[model samples]
Target: MVELRRSLSLVSTFLILFCTSTTAQPPAPRRSRTRAYIEVSCQITEYPDLCIRSLTAYIHGANATILSPRKLVHYALLASQHRAQHTRAFLLQVSKPLKAKKDQEYQAVKDCLEQIDMSVDQLSMSIKELRQLGREEATPSPSRDDVVWHISNMETWVGSALTDATTCLDEFPGGVRMSRMKATVKAKVLNVAQVTGNALSLFHHFVVRYRVPGSPKKP
Candidate 1:
């Protein structure tokens, strides 16, 4: 009778400890506040899903816990830059095997390689200009005009990247034999263009909502 009572007590003690340990652990982390904010901000873009996905991946890779508007814009541009670079590499690799074919499709791939390379450069420049915006703003005698010019330059570069992607597709002759290669090129280029377009939209939103350090105030 005593052993049975002791066994019951041990079981009760184990249950109590288990419950206490579980309850003492911190609650599961809630959805990231920054992710929620990004979702809302991305709604302004035509490709909201792409925007969110790209930014979320950036956030994860960067482990960016705190972010400002400029930082957010930088991240978006960086993501766009990465996408363009990957597409460029893909084109380069695929073109290697077709170099000897000397066909129309080979010619198309050659042209696309040039345009995508250009697009990669434009995006690289955009990121450079974005960083320049911050440096210009941080100067002791910051110039509103300079900041405006840099912002304008970023917009133009991003737009040009989009344009370059389209030009790449236009180079591929219609109804070609290399439909598989052409389709892959089309998809990759379009993905870069769409992501850049979303970044462009974010640039506008950043301009409207968060004034740069050197931006002029309304009279």
Candidate 2:
């Protein structure tokens, strides 16, 4: 009888250990590559020029790519603004315990608000510079080569900003929060991509429309 009881106890111990191990394993990370791609495509089609402008702005402003410093900044600003606008909504959704000690959370939210303000200030400054450069390039009397050089410089600055933004996103730690932020940034970057493509298309169209009919196509 003693031996039998000991055996039963050992079996129970093993079962408990097995159950704990199995339950403790984290759930497999959710893969949403397809959904992400679709979201990116949708965002790209919405406003190509703004997308391009944002991309350029990010490059010139942050030395990053479309998604890195650029998109990250864009979404950060957006999320910050969103937080500010829905202060009451967020407070309502918190658990009772957290709500009871809301001051700490409010401080964090306030910091986020400050970050958004800084991003807006930086973006505004970048846009002003870009507009000035654009106007200079647009002057009717400038030589064709000079205009091209200015445009190329503008493009380079935009591309750099995009690179920076994407890099920042890549450095974020893996988790649900990062994934969600990534999705938001990707969506915004796609918009910038669409805008870039559209601007190029429109520029080409303008060239075609104004070309002297009898002039031979430039080689």
Candidate 3:
């Protein structure tokens, strides 16, 4: 009887351990929650599908609980910066084989390369500002004005990047509209512009929703 009672007690203990482990939320639930959060946040953009596609990978492993609104904006900007870098590289490839013709069409391609380069630089500055914003928020005592200031600067930089991307297509004369080269460049630049727009929109959304840690209303 003593041995039987000990065996029964061990079985009860094992059952308790199994139940405790099952009570905690598993990784699959965390991953789905994270994905859902990203999808909802991207709905604010004009190109929601594109926004989700670009951003989901950035926070793929992170749980939804840890992703603050500011972090969402940061990840969006990172996606924009990456898109701009890739577009710039593509522009360089497009420029190499073309002869330096004096025509407007050829010159537009040349101008686009410079424009994308500028966009890349602008995005780099914006990405740095995002990093600064993160550090500022993580402080023991963060200032409201400082956070607003950093966000404002980032907005301006991203806006400039969007303009730069669109201007690549603008330099072409009306007659050369959507020529083969221009069309090729347009496809790439348009991608950059859309992603930059997504980043800019995310900033606005985040700022509107952001509130001080203890404040009842948004700052």
Report the error of model 3 at residue 192, Å: 0.6
Q: lDDT by residue for model 3 over 1-219, one digit each (tens)?
A: 999999999999999999999987566635456578878888999999998888877655443332566677777877888887887787777666664444555566778888888888988898899788778877777777888788788888889989998888577545654768777678778888998898888888877644445522322
All models, RMSD in angstroms: 3.8, 18.5, 8.4
Q: Whose TM-score is higher: candidate 1's or candidate 2's?
A: 1
lDDT (C-alpha) at residue 84 in model 2: 27
lDDT (0-100) at residue 155 of candidate 3?
83
Q: Tell me the lDDT of model 3 at 147.
A: 80
* Position 213, candidate 2: lDDT: 40
CA shift at 131, candidate 3, in angstroms? 1.5
Off by over 4 Å in 2: 1-140, 173-219
**Order of the predicted models by lDDT, top scorer first:** 1, 3, 2
- Predictions in order: lDDT: 0.82, 0.40, 0.77
Error of 3 at 13 (Å): 37
Best-matching candidate per lDDT: 1
By TM-score rank, best first, the candidates go 1, 3, 2
Candidate 3 accuracy as TM-score: 0.73
For model 1, what is the alpha-carbon lDDT of residue 136? 83
Candidate 3, 136: how far from true, in Å? 1.7
Mind giving the per-residue lDDT tens digits that candidate 2 earns over 1-219? 999999999999999999999999999976344323323532433454353444344344665443322233333233222322343233234324443677444333334333333433433443444455446545655355544554354345434433433332343334645334335433443333333333333333323422444422222
**True lDDT of residue 2, candidate 1:** 100
